[model samples]
Target: MARPTTLLACCKLYISESRNDAALRAIEQAARGGGGGAVVVNRFTDDAYNRVGYTLVAPLTPSPAPPPLRHAVLGMVRAALEAIDFGAHAGTHPRLGAVDHICFHPLAHASLRHVADLAGAVAADIGDELQVPTFLYGAAHREGRTLASIRRQLGYFKPNSSGDQWRGAPETDALPVAPDAGPERPPRSKGVVVVGATSWVDNYNVPVHTGDVEAARRIARAVSERGGGLPSVQAMGLAHGGGVVEVACNLLDPARVGAEQVQGMVERLAAGEGLSVGKGYFTDFSQDKIVDLYFRSAANTEG
Candidate 1:
């Protein structure tokens, strides 16, 4: 049968271990199963955060059986859950689980509903098979809940230890809200996972010259939409080692607000505090770029 042209799905997973290249390789290997042409668009590791992010893209064609893209993502999640032990995990990044966060984005002709369906499927598998607590966000949830709100309710932004480390295990056995899947009590080793489907978002970070995380936090709040700054933007301040702090931001609508605007805002905020802002960075490529790359790769493989 000829391959059907279809929408693209991008699965971005944030695993707890950044220093272990072997674990990353294991996840990648699992994602490449069944001869699926799932492309790894980006793989980033932050030692200070002790987290790794892998962005995988694949064509999502209708099938009688489970789709290859979905299978690939679940395989990777299983691999990550097995490799990472959140009980001993510690990092600057705030997380609620070993898998931490997994977000599915629609690219090309894909609809939000399409990705949301996939998110729901993954959540079910993670809950039923893996027995991990799973929360749904964005379009996946009927309430149109945001990831930030869920994280906030779960105390995800707070660190269990000084210098942003969550050690030994999550503090609470009971969640503020019952998870969409799995047991209500968080697992000791794996904790819980947040799965969502949302429109394309850009993860951008702006570095500041100062070492004061509190000042960075102030700047982050000042420039966030919640703080009455930019619209469709979520910002957080974090220490990135080396006497430097960063304003990590998620630009929900790049067309409405993008990395440039975020950089400008951070610069303006830093200047008022006698701090200098460094050039910002985008952790992943745009959705269009990722779709283009996937097709080019598919074409090459066909050739």
Candidate 2:
């Protein structure tokens, strides 16, 4: 969130207790480390009862003239958030939001209600603070709630005030999807954001260690739209904590796509390069507590 100059606005953020302290510490630590724009601390609606961060950065680019078409036509929501970045050339993860959509993962919280309340409260604050009208969504609150199921809600609301709860409609290469707010920002020439909450989507990543970075990148690229791969899957190649070139993907449905599939795909991609995935690793997928599949898996693993 500290990445400055390009962050026009922020929402749906994950600033944990440690993050807040680090941000506060960075205030004093800046001079000790380097300098400038290193700390930020703000009061949330109910300080004692909420855990959520909503940060939006304005893109620094030629606005809609650049790559808004890709998002508009391809239905790649993250690009809408990128449109507002004001500088996609220097941006973080791909996103789709004037305020990005947020799904709360219950880790520290005692109940889903706890996080939902925090999310709704945070959204309310953003609406009030930014003067950007918004609707809080989830099981707790009921204002402007979407009635459709997952299949129906995917494109329930457009970036320009169009409600397309049903799919298979002609995609809008560059249409204005009005914000949930009444007076939406005049389509930054690109598009807009659809922010809310939903069931936990799987966050799965795969790492390759064939020493062929470009080859891994190609596989990642193929897995993502930039190359054309899975449906409802956002993918990319990165060199990070993983010891090797990794093909990271956000699998929308763990049932259809899991660690096994990702491992399989990477192995197949590595064939031409004569390399293989170092290890099968999976993490950061949230499933409802009511669904005991993972809980049982955890038990079996322990057994």
Candidate 3:
């Protein structure tokens, strides 16, 4: 049998875990068994954040309408919930659920509308089957809400427990804003999840050789568009454990303003602070590399 010539899309799912290799393995196994035509091209795990990010690619056309990306994401979320307890979860990165965030991006010939549809389906699956509150943003939202907007409404940027860390469950029985899907009250052990679909985004991190997270935050603010700096960039300074802090950035428009620009700005800002800066790194493969890996994985599967 020959596979159909189809458009491709990518889904980046962030689950809460860096330790417990057994649990992470089980989650990946469950995702693979979910029967999605999707292939996970990359898995990035951050120890300080205690998070695992999976990059999955799938055909947007052919093989059962809507594909099985929803099944795969749902399977991962379910496995994560089973393995992780939000009440005991603590990390430098801010998050809400065992499955922290899931975002879909159109790739190659895939359309944003189609990817948004897939995102909505996955959100519905988690909301209906698992009975979890799922919030929608980006193209999946009716009003085209941004993920940052939803995060702000949910107090995602603020640390709930320590001065610099988020520990235990989110401090709300009932959500401040009604969820786009699922119940009003979140289940204690498995907080709420945010889902969305958007254009390709670049994840870049510039490390500063300093433990002062606040200084890092100042540099991050100055580098972000929100603080009268780079256009089409969103940034946050986070402590990555050790004596290092990172200005984690999401380049919304990498084509116009790439990682090099962000890196230079960080370097200049850190120099002023008397902090040495390390070369930044991307958290995932490039678009061309991702496409190559997807096709290779598909061929291996078909063979």
Candidate 4:
């Protein structure tokens, strides 16, 4: 069979493990090998959040053929599951598992359906082989579920331990909803994983110069779509270091709503509360930027 032209698919993994950079790097290396040359576009680690975000891209295998992206993601998850213990993990960010969340995005000419298939395959592997409960969201979900909805159902916002810390396993064997893969009950230590596929989205954060988390939460509500703010936007108020709060936003459609608009709205709303807004920052590179970097690295490797 002839090999199809290469297309791009990006995967983002939110891991509960980040304190050890070397361990994360080892997982990334294993992921690259499983990806069959997937590029690591960007990685961000937060000590406060006690989490890490890894963005990787690989060429999509032809239709009806097993794509390396699935293998790549599973390899990373396996490494994470082995190295990280969620029972002793704690972070400000809401999480349900060691490998908390996994999202796949189609780039270039790749279709959403293609990435969705990859998400499903990875979810199954993590659930069955690893025996961790896994939920599907976004395009990979038949009901078109959203991540926020699933998180809310899982009591992610609530801290089981103390002071924003999560310890032990999930409280109940009976979850609000059945997982798409794995056992209905969550296993010890690993918890559960949320896997999905969607279009390119930007995660932007704007710092608020105030210790009042309530004010930040209020601003987040005002800037979110549910709050009748911008279309295709989601916002959250998070506590940063040094008495500073942040308005973290997810731009679902950059064409519809960009960082500038989010920043403007946040600044305007924060000013009403006498809070000044700092410059906004994106967590990862844009899809176009990632693709360009991938090609450049590929060229350098070949040369």
Candidate 4 TM-score, C-alpha based: 0.93
Candidate 4 regions with alpha-carbon error over 4 angstroms: 1-5, 63-65, 160-169
Across residues 44-84, which tens digit of lDDT does each residue of candidate 1 receive?
88998898888988877776767667788788889988887
**Better structure of 3 and 4 per lDDT:** 3
lDDT of 3 by residue, 125-199 (tens): 888888899999999999999988899999999987667798888665878899878888888889999999999
- Give the per-residue lDDT of model 4 (tens digit) for 1-303: 111455789999999877877778778878767735677778988787788998988788665757777787888999988887777787667789889999999987799998998899999999999999999999999988998899899888676765435565676767898899999888667889999999999999999999787798899999999899999999988777688888889899998899999999999999999888899999999888988887777677667
Task: For candidate 1, report its TM-score.
Answer: 0.95
Number of colliding residue pairs in each model: 0, 31, 0, 0
Error of 1 at 75 (Å): 0.8
Task: Compare candidates 2 and 4 on lDDT and give the better one.
Answer: 4
State the lDDT of candidate 2 residue by residue for 140-239, as single tens digits. Answer: 3455363122213434323221221111222443324333442344233222323344444565667677545467678876765436666556565654
Which residue pairs collide, candidate 3? none
lDDT (Cα, 0-100) at 171 in candidate 3: 63
List the candidate 3 regions with Cα displacement exceeding 4 Å. Answer: 1-5
What's the CA error at residue 95 for candidate 3, in Å?
A: 0.6
Number of the top lDDT candidate: 3
lDDT of 1 at 117: 92
